[model samples]
Target: MSPALHRRLPLLATAAVLVGLYASGGLLYDGFLSGRVALNLLADNAALGLTAVGLTLVIFSGGIDLSVGAVVGFTSIFTATLVERHGVHPALAAAAALAVGGALGAGMGALIHWFRQPPFLITLAGMFLMRGGAYWISTESVGLTHPLYNRLAAYELPLGGRLGLPVTSLVLLAALALGGIIAHYTRFGRNLLALGGSESSALLMGVPLAGTRIAVYALSSLAATVAGLVLALYTGSGNPTFGLGLELDAIAVVVIGGTLLRGGRGHLLGTLLGLLVFGVIQTALTFDGRLSAQWGRIIVGALLLAFILVQRLLHERLGRRRDPIHTV
Candidate 1:
């Protein structure tokens, strides 16, 4: 393949996966077309889709955010506790959640840039710290009698008949569009790509390395806050442990979306497709009836591992030998 076409290989592969999964829905089971399928996917996978968008940006900057899941976990409590205790306006509460997430991300980015620490370690430490804080804030399960949360999350737009869509899906899509616009048309987006492609080169070229880097992490944290907010609303409660494994799920979608873990390569559109593909995997597996819930994790792990190996091979063949990349 020509170099230009080669860059599209992962996208083509992801499209194939999507087509195959959609076509196999018939073979998967009778309920494939049911409202249950759509609703479960919406409730369970939509937040992860939002989470994946930010990870796409962070990964494009050649850094992994191990703290996103924890941020979500913590934000669930923060949003809930604030609304319940302080009677804050819904919009203001939402903004506060995003600000908190962004601040945490910016702090980590500053640490990484100034102290020259690896993102993995920095984010890992952040993950533990956030989780501990969540526990400290609310050592017990907090339910969604919070009036503000109940209104936003429980509000439903009726589609027709007995079917209705949750407000959360709309929120997720809006955020996705916002992310796409920023990524495709903004200077910060260009700076991020440059940074990902070559940190030293970006610095040498004077790309506002610190500010943009900080912004990228802030965006990621902001995303996590959105997910946590919607999720808290949907579930009618907040728990420090609700989305224990969502960070991995978000990373998986971002990777499957064709974002090279090594930085400098990513796609917002691909992330959407990847989210649908993963949603189907879980829904289809559940529809099949013979598989246990744990099977979802096992199959996802295997799929992610296989994808990593394929990406590694692609990198080896097409990427420079000395320039390493993660099979994100």
Candidate 2:
């Protein structure tokens, strides 16, 4: 296999599954076989894809972030609440959400750096805090009726005729492009990979280790905030509990995209492929309505486990350094 194809082996397999689903979609619902479904697929994957992009960076830096689901939850709820209760401008509300998300990320980064606690524990605490905070903001789900939010959320640019690209999707794609540039061209990007590879050595080599890791988390939060806003707009409502299991999905997408879960290795293209696979699976599952969404989770978990096992076996065969965490 060529380098690019080898790198995206998992995604390529997922694409085959997507084609299978599309074929199966015809048998279940003729509507699902339409171009509309394809449009919806892109729309549905946009927010998840954006969040996964940010997460790919954090994972690449050798850290796990559990607070992302909560952060997206919090930001979504906050956006809707502010529009309904305070009449905040959509632009200003968006800015506030991003700033708060960044602050939360910075806090978690500080905790990990200063206390020497594993990120798992710190972000777990963050998850609860943000989830509860979402409830505190609104005990009930809220939908947007504001003229501004409605206009912005539903706005579409003419891509051709009946087919059009949504403003939300366009903005999300723009964010993805910006993230790709940051990941490949910047000093911060190099530092993130170097730090994950060997923090001690990276520091000794003057890679600005602390700042890079801290910023990576912050960027993750910022991306989550952006997704949250788009979600509120598209759904015309906020579900504080909506992203309950999304962090796992994001992590799975990162890994499936060809990014290593253990960190120090990953790319944006891998994440994009991962999102495509996830979208295809969900689309296929929806076509078979008799199957529960719960089954989707089970399948996702199985896939994650299988990929992890493959990595471990590869490492063993290569005689690379073994991880102490999962050896037993």
157-265 per-residue lDDT for model 2 (tens digits): 8777698778777866787788778887888887888877678878898998667877888998888888888778778888798578788899988876767777776
Clashing pairs in 1: none
Highest TM-score against the true fold, candidate: 1
Models 1 onward score TM values of: 0.91, 0.88
Query: Could you tell me the C-alpha RMSD of candidate 2 in Å?
Result: 3.3
Against the reference, the lDDT scores of all candidates come to 0.82, 0.79
Q: In model 2, how large is the Cα lDDT of residue 136? A: 94
For 243-311, candidate 1 gives per-residue lDDT tens digits of: 687889999988887778999877788888788889989888877778888888887787788777877
Best by lDDT: 1
Residue 270's lDDT in candidate 2: 65
